[model samples]
Target: MAHDVQLEAITYETKEEVPQELKEKKLSWQKLRRYDSLDLESRSIPGHHHGHHSKALTRSLIFRLAFQSIGVVYGDVGTSPLYVFASTFPNGIGNNDDILGVLSLIFYTITLITVIKYVLIVLKANDNGEGGTFALYSLLCRYAKVGFIPNQQAEDRDVSNYELELPSGRAWMASWLKSALEKSMFAKQILLFATMLGTSMLIGDGVLTPCISVLSAVGGIQVATTKVTQDMVVWISVVILILLFLIQRFGTDKVGYSFAPIICVWFALIGGIGLYNFIQYDPAVAKALNPKYIIDYFKRNKKGAWVSLGGVVLAITGTEALFADLGHFTVPSVQISMCFVTYPALILAYAGQASFLRMNNDLVKETFYKSIPKPIYWPTFVIAVLASIIASQAIISGTFSIIQQSLSLGCFPRVKVIHTSTKYEGQVYVPEANYLLMVACVAVTLGFRTTTNIGNAYGIAVVFVMTLTSCFLVLIMIMIWKTHIILVLVYILIIGSVELLYLSSVLYKFDQGGYLPVAFATVLMIVMYTWNSVFRRKYHYELEHKISPEKLKEVVGGISLHRIPGLAMFYSELVQGIPPIFKHYVANVPALHSVLVFVSIKSLPISKVPVSERFLFRHVEPKDLNVFRCVVRYGYTDVQNEQEPFEKLLIENLKVFIRDGFGLPQSVLSNGENGEEIMDVRQVEEDMQPAEIEREIEAVDKAWHAGIVHLIGETEVVAGKGSSIGKKILIDYAYTFLRRNLRESDDVLTIPHKRMLKVGMTYEL
Candidate 1:
């Protein structure tokens, strides 16, 4: 007999006709009946609204986006002029030779790291249109089965952003490399560890960028007047930092509108001043552009020049922002803004500062303010402060984005993610992360009280992240790009050697504040590792013990089960079959809802999943069973809707699937009455008018009006009976404690309390 025939043979019993033993076990029906009289006419879920908007990319739109990219993407590197010279040369400039050498190093570092490595190379490694460490890792996973999640489906590969095309003739090597990585569990674990370490370091950047940028900018107040002490600078910076974080909930779309113009003026002012100083003070300072001066500087002051590379690294402090912010702005937009506006302006600004220092070596510490032609000192100071705030805003927003990606990929604990803009999906705000970052920023400002110390810490975080990026980029070049071996080696050696040199210089100052990022990364690494390990273990445990659909049907048919009037949606992590939690619930309750839906929400390796392609549905057995499964997918950059919108969209899709049988054959729609064929699904769908579809929806609405309950499994993980003590402490104690303290599943699901049914279960892993 066919599967459909088997399903049709089973008869569903109404609630009143249920056996007395089953009625006694069906305790939840009484609570569900309380909603029987409630209104179901309103299709909207409370507190849920669909406000997402998409814009077209017209010429005017692209230009506008490119212009906005200036303020958000280039602010940190643009403001490097304020303190780079001061940080590099703490004492007065010894001679013209030292000035040329430091300037040469700064120029080359910016050109090599910022221009060639990032703008030209790293930007191409973006995952689909998205960039960042997580984005790169996501792209790598597409080429190899290195993702932590094991339940990935074939349909997941059909997502828009998961598309990857190798060169016409290099398919064999790509296939071999992918196979090798997938076959080894150890390799996958190592890849995840490296990616998580890079992500943690970027989070550390969020804390340090604001502290250094604001402190360095506000330090101008002390230069303008001897009465303004370092203590005053610290207080002012703290106030500014507080204000910057306080308005984060408003989001980047509003905050970023004014950033472009303010930064435009700042760049023009710096560039023009640089040109003026280079001409009037010392035109010969242009000699710093020669690479020979870099060699001569290192030769002249071997150890001193090496130590000063830490400060030179500051020139590219926010280089990662260029790539990370790709989801917000396009590659062409960022590239244009950097090459045309930001790059030239920064180079000129640095050249001007060097020229000023060459002529007036006594004012080395105040090179930026002193170099200003005096007429625009106060105005320039105000612009500098605004520019620094803009830089801080950019990184804070980037930090929020990274955390959201981490949560979706199961590498971070769940936190409330609020989409702050309707126009841009990537514009988001996390209240908890925002406040925590603000507190860290204030502490750093007060503790360091000087750009010198903060810059040391900032340099270490920046270089370490860059090095990790280079490491990931090497694999991307070979496995994805399929580039020639010689070319890959050249790319890695050049990028890796420079980053390591800077890394060594920063490490040499370990006692002088360089340990801050190390400490920050260490703590974050622990959190990420613990959360991900526990999550993976639980998933594997569930996968090993999942009940097949055939077994589930057998269990249901073995008993005379009662079908209640409403829908019951069960959320599970597994993509196929029934989770153990469902079996556990049915055994205890002995009754099921009229409609059963197993919803599996999975995150795909893409930036955004289109609304039309979000839900995939299939029948678990047949229509008579009222058991269906839905696999709803989301991209890392996608925002999850609240309950009302989610429920509305789900029911709408379910109706379409029912009407069309999701393209099933006409024979499959025949009723089991003497094996007679009923109306064909295609014929019914073609004959149905809008009114009939609306009426079908109305019927579903009436059933939902009775009440809808969300069944979630609350599982406790512990070591198996035969496990070692080390495993017991890690799983039973540490993992359990963290799970208790972190955000609960209810908070993430946003399920209404009155309509929720949690089934508790324990897993010995």
Candidate 2:
């Protein structure tokens, strides 16, 4: 029966295993369809248009997004003015001339790092409109086979927007670089580890940003009057952090809408106040914008200036959030918001503080609040606190987005992800991550208890993330943009030197407080590495243990089992062959379902898969077996919780397949050898009687109604007898601990407890 099955039954053998006889055969149906067993590429990319510039966007919409982006993308960077000056001169200003030099560093750092590196360059490296370290890694994976996961197949490359656009010979350097990255296992591991380390550090930024931003804002109470003690401010900031994270379940859409106006008002007030101070105090202080001051100030201060860079880098702390949050906005909007609004406001804010310091150098610690006119001090203080909260909110949401992406890529443990907006696919809320971040933020605030200490930790996280972004962006420019090698070298010479300088300064302060993010990142990297390593091993085990059609028939024949009435949906991660767990289930169970469907839920690297192209169907061999394989592909941002609609669509596609006679070739149906004749599937459909098609559809409908049971494999991992101690510690201990503690596959899928059947098994990796 298996041998007699039609050519439409897609075989599950690798390319090397397929015989020349099978390769020569083709059907009329294969000619009509865009996809076939031999060719899997799509005619068009799904739900995404690729270009450096966004398509079909209006100027007004860009401006509107620009306005909204201020609340989300710029909040963290914008709030830097509240603490940068204070942190820079922690021991108070030495010479009035030092103010000019510090201001020069602030100006050049924001322009070089934020405006040029990010807004102009790194933003263009986005993968199908999604941005981040993972997006960059995904982009690299598309161009080259450097991804750590071994589960990717040829069909994965067929996903829309996943195709590689070959560069011309002009980019020979890039071509050489790509070849090197693909061939070197050691290099691939380093790239993967660095990307993970960057992501872990970003998560650390999420915890520290809120701690310092809120504390600095509330510290204005001490400046306003002596009534508010430092401890009181710490407790007050803790309360605000608790309240800020509590509202995260409302998601970015609501939070952005509510916070946008407050942030706008805050930016306006600071800009206005800065201009006033610049005019009233010392207009001559504008000379600080000269590059020479940066040189002279360093010469004058020596080691003190280098250490002050630990504080100077704070001016650009939120730069990562700008690129990380690009998925939520257009490049034009982020660029306009930064270049026109956020950039100017920060400059004037720092300038006004510098001008005031020129006259009253004694108030360096109190520069921001002291520079404000007494009449509006109280009102400005209120807005400062609100802006700080908004800044905290933005980074927290960005953290959730990154973790959700990691979970989809199998780099993190399973967690509950709630889609917060119906219109925007990127808006998501992770309940578990949110609470954990909140707790970490509170603990840090209580432990450090001052803005200066937290500022040390904050600068380390920020600079380290920036350094990693530069490294990733360099590769992207070479391999993706195919930029000239000379220009890439120049970029490294300039940006690389500045970031390394700051990196050294922060490392100098490791004992003061900089150890926090390092500790956080190390722990997170271990968790991620453990989960991803175990997942890849398990997938390989299934791939190696796959059962052939002959073996499957033997098992069924030996069971002598009754064909029960409903449909059994066996879920696994394997895309091609039947998993070993299915054989284990059949051997132990007394009965089998009449219709069996093997369902594989796969996550593609793209942002969203179109509904029309979501399901790929393949009939298993043996016409009487009634076994089918359905590979449901989803983009990383696509919602997968709609169970009823998913079931309806699956059943409907199966009915269509049956009605068309599985698109059978004429030779197979008529017992001719080697597909000597061909018949189109449309002709077969036309020949079928309406009643016969209806009866076939009715049988499937009845089976579906009889009750669908979801079969999920619950596998445990242990080291093989031949394995060493390291394998045992990694698999038996770390993997097992994470598997038992984290959310299970059934829970993440929202499978009902009554309908889910767990088949337990163990694997010796």
Each candidate's lDDT (Cα)?
A: 0.77, 0.79
Question: TM-scores for all candidates?
Answer: 0.87, 0.91
Show model 1 residue runs off by greater than 4 Å: 1-58, 150-152, 554-560, 663-702
Candidate 1 per-residue lDDT, tens place, 1-765, comes to 000000001111111121232224333323211110011111222222222223456877778878989988988888889888888887656667899999898888888999999999999887767899988887777667777643223455444445565655666766788789889989888887888888888999999999999998998988889999889989999999999999998878899767899999999999999999989889898888788998988888899889999988998889999999988787778888889998899999999988888878888877888899888999999999999999999999999988888876677766778788887668878877899899989999999988889988999989988998898888888788888779888987887889999999999988999999888889888877777777777776776688876787776555577778888889887655567888888888888877788887777766777776677776555345667777677878887745228887877777666554342333434453454333333343455455654664555666577778899888889899999988888788878877888666766777788889899999999
Backbone clash total for model 1 is 1
* Ten residues in sequence with the least summed lDDT for candidate 1: 1-10
What is the C-alpha lDDT profile of model 2 across 1-765, one tens digit per residue?
A: 000001011334634222333334455334334333322322332233433333689999999989988888878888888888889999998888898999999999999998989998889888777788878877776677676542235555555566656556667877789899989989988988888898899999999999999999999999989999999999999999999999889877888656778888889988999999999888887887789999999999999999999999999988988888888888898999989999998888888888888899888777788889999999999999999999998898888888877775677877887778876657778888999999999999999998899999998999998898899889888887888779999999999999999999999999999999999999999998888887788877877897776887776556587789898888887765788988889879957777788887766656566676677766665535667787777766666654327777878877767665552433333322554333334455555557765776776787898989889987887999989888899999998898888788887777778988999888888
For every candidate in turn, the CA RMSD to the true structure comes to: 10.2, 5.0
Q: What is the lDDT of residue 277 in candidate 2?
A: 90
Residue 418, model 2: Cα distance from true site in angstroms = 1.5
In candidate 1, position 127 carries an lDDT of 72
